[model samples]
Target: MTIRFRPSEPTDAAALLRVWRRAVDGTHHFLSAQDRVAIDPLVADYVGSTALRIAEKDGEVVAFMGVTGQNVDSLFIDPAAHGSGIGRSLVDEVARPTTVEVNEQNEGAVAFYKRLGFEVTSRSETDEDGRPYPLLHMRRD
Candidate 1:
C-alpha cells in the first residue's frame, strides 16, 4: 500500500484520536483501566491542539506523530496497521527526534526506538501525568 505523509489539519483531530485509542489499547497493556479512562480526555485535548505529522494509507489516517524541537512527544499507529513500517517512516521523514520517551513497560516500543538508534538515557518512576507506569528517557544523539 502507498503511504502519504502530511502535516495534520484541524479536521484530522478525530481521526488521530481514533488511531491513538486503538494504538494504546493494543500496546499499552500495563495501563490501569482507571488510568486509561482518566487519560482519554487529556489525549483528546492534546490531539486537537498539537501539530502532528500524519500518515495516510488509501485515504485513511493510519498513523501520526508529534514532534517539538528535537523531541518526539508522541507516535501512534492504528493497531490494524502495525508492522507496516509506517512508524519508522514517520520518524525518518518527519519527526527525526533526537530525544524520545516511551513507557518502560512497553517492550515493543523500546525495541522499535532502539532499532531506530535511540538509547536509554534515564528512567522515571512514573509517567508525566504522575501515573504509576515508569518511563524511559531515550536519545539518539
Candidate 2:
C-alpha cells in the first residue's frame, strides 16, 4: 500500500468530487435519498475557500483534501481506503495552525482532529446556510 501525495490539478476534479460527495452523504444522514445528491461538480471550485490536494495510490486518487487559507475545506477518503493514513498525511504535509467547520453531527472527524492535538476554540454556524454547523478552531501544536 504505497500512497503518494501530489498537488491537485484541474484534471483530477471529477475524482475529487466523488470522494467529497461520499463524505457529504455521510454527514447528511437526515437528508432524503433524493436530496443526498451533490449539487454539481462545479460547486467545489466555487466554494470560495478551497485549495485542493489529491492523494493517489497506484496512480489513482484515493483521497482528496482542500486547504483554504488556514481552514481545512474538506478531507475525504474512499470508504475502502479508510485508516490507510491518508488523512494524517494531508494534515502533516500541510501542517499549519488550522481551522475547520465540521458538521456538528460528524463526531468521528471531530474526535480525530482532537486526537491530532487540535483544540476547539469556538463553534459557529455556516454562512447563511442556516445549517447550524460548528466552527471548530484549532491551533496546531
Best by lDDT: 1
lDDT of 1 by residue, 1-141 (tens): 788999999899899999999999999999999999999999899989988999999899999999988888899999899889999988876344489999999998999999999999999999997989999999886
lDDT of 1: 0.91
Please estimate how well model 2 matches the true structure, expressed as its whole-model Cα lDDT.
0.68
The CA lDDT of each predicted structure is 0.91, 0.68
All candidates: CA RMSD (Å): 1.3, 3.0
Q: After the best TM-score superposition of candidate 1, give how far the Cα of residue 29 lies from its true spot, in angstroms.
A: 0.7
| TM per candidate | 0.95, 0.79
**Model 2 bad stretches (over 4 Å):** 30-51, 126-128
TM-score of 1: 0.95
Clashes per candidate (backbone, < 3 Å): 0, 0
In terms of TM-score, how similar is model 2 to the real structure? 0.79
- Candidate 1: RMSD to truth: 1.3
